[model samples]
Target: MSRMNRFLYSLADGLKGILRNLMMSLMSFSMLIGSLLVVGSLSLLVVNIDAIIQDLGDQNEIMVYVHEEYDDSEFNQISQAIMEAEHVVGFTFVSRETALEEMKNDLEEYASILEGMEQDNPLRDGFRIQVDDPANVEAVVTAMEGVDGIGNVEARTDVVESFLKTRNAVNLISIGLMVLLAGISTFIIMNTIKMSAYTRREEIAIMRMVGATKGTIRLSFVTEAMIICLCGSIVSFFAIMFLYQELIEKAFSSTGLLQAVPFQEVWGGVLLIFVGASLVIGVLGSLLSINKYLKV
Candidate 1:
């Protein structure tokens, strides 16, 4: 037979296998749909939470206070030294007078309480340093502390540490969950494919005896698995979309800051990953399932 004819026959056999075991095929695809949806949702949640943490980290700057008695020239030197510090993106110098004015505006109702303290404002001059990376904030703080004319470094180390810990915890949990789900999904898919291969064992044996190549039989089974996974991935995409819509409505109150990633922006990559992963699962499942039968 021609290669084209062989291809046609293999495609036909694959479709027949799917239809012959309709219930099993449906169950396999359904499992894929559910698992993929869960994975996609978790991925979006992790991305959104990370974004929120980063936004909060950006708002909180590293406060480096200079010596109160430092002259203009000395302060300039300190500021230049800080700018040269690693991870220091930029710095703003707030003088004692400016700090006093800000304090007054903040405590307008208690203006009388501050009236007697104006002659000896206790506010110190400080440089508000913007950190280039939140992960390096401690390093920036340590570097600032070593600068000459620097009196103190006021950093929310606890807050920064907590944020970093949250991000790391979330990341570790997400990775673990994804790995577990991938393994389970792959196991189920392999078993499902094995069932189909087992059903056709006698036919495969006869084909082998008739001189039909082992490659042809493997091709047919692999093709069947691919078709099942392709359909499953496509259905899973729409199911995920529907579930996400409901989730945004009920699970999320307002789509302001902690919103999940928009499906539109990520659907392309999601679909690519879903389909690619499904294909991998299907192909490997077929290979693993067909190994014993190949000897026939």
Candidate 2:
């Protein structure tokens, strides 16, 4: 046969193999869906945590207030101290004048109160500190308290600590769920592939005896495995879309602190990775499991 004819023959054989093992195909599809669903959900959870971290970096910060008696030039000492402090990513000096202006803008209703303080602006010069890591806010706060020119360090440790706990919990969940789903998928796929190989034993044997190379026979089974995985991955992608939409509506709509990353921004990458992982698992799993039958 010509090379093109040979390719067509192999392709036809692969399609026939998939349709003939309809029951096994369905079983494999179900297993893939279950596994991919858990994997995708955990991935989304990780993405949410990362988004929360970025938001925290922007919205939450530590304020290191300079002593009232400290001279403006003495701020260099505080800046130098902060530079040496661990976990400090960035800082900005807010002069008393700037602080007063901010207060006026934020407390417009109490503009008179702020204007009254203009004669004696009680607001001190301070450093707005940005911690590089939310998890290290406590450490950063502790260090800030010791800065030489600082009178007080104000960090919302409570909020940062809460997010820290959540991050750890989600990380643990992702690892545990991934392991569990992989095992379940492997178990189901192994069984289904064994049954598929068994039912097609005669066909496989005939192909082998009739000048068919082992690689050709193996290719057909692998193709079927890939087909099943692709279908499951597609289904799981849609399911994830629905789930994320529900989360946005029911969870994020009420809380601005937690915003959903738009699906359009991340779904393409997520889908690419999901399809790649599923294909690797499907093709490799079949190649390994179907080997005992082929002896090739």
Candidate 1 lDDT, 30-145, residue by residue in tens: 87777787777777666666665677567768877888787889977897898788877788988888888998999999998899677898989898888876678888888888
TM-score of each: 0.83, 0.85
Candidates in order have lDDT scores of 0.80, 0.79
- Which residue runs does candidate 2 get wrong by more than 4 Å? 1-7, 83-89, 108-122, 246-250, 254-257
Model 1 misplacement above 4 A: 1-5, 97-122, 249-259
TM-score of candidate 1 versus the correct structure, residues matched by position: 0.83
Clash count in backbone of candidate 1: 0
What are the per-residue Cα lDDT tens digits for candidate 2 across 138-200? 898888887778898888878767777787898898788877876777666666667778888
Worst 10 residues of 2 by lDDT: 249-258
Best by TM-score, which number? Answer: 2
Model 1 pairs whose backbones collide:
none
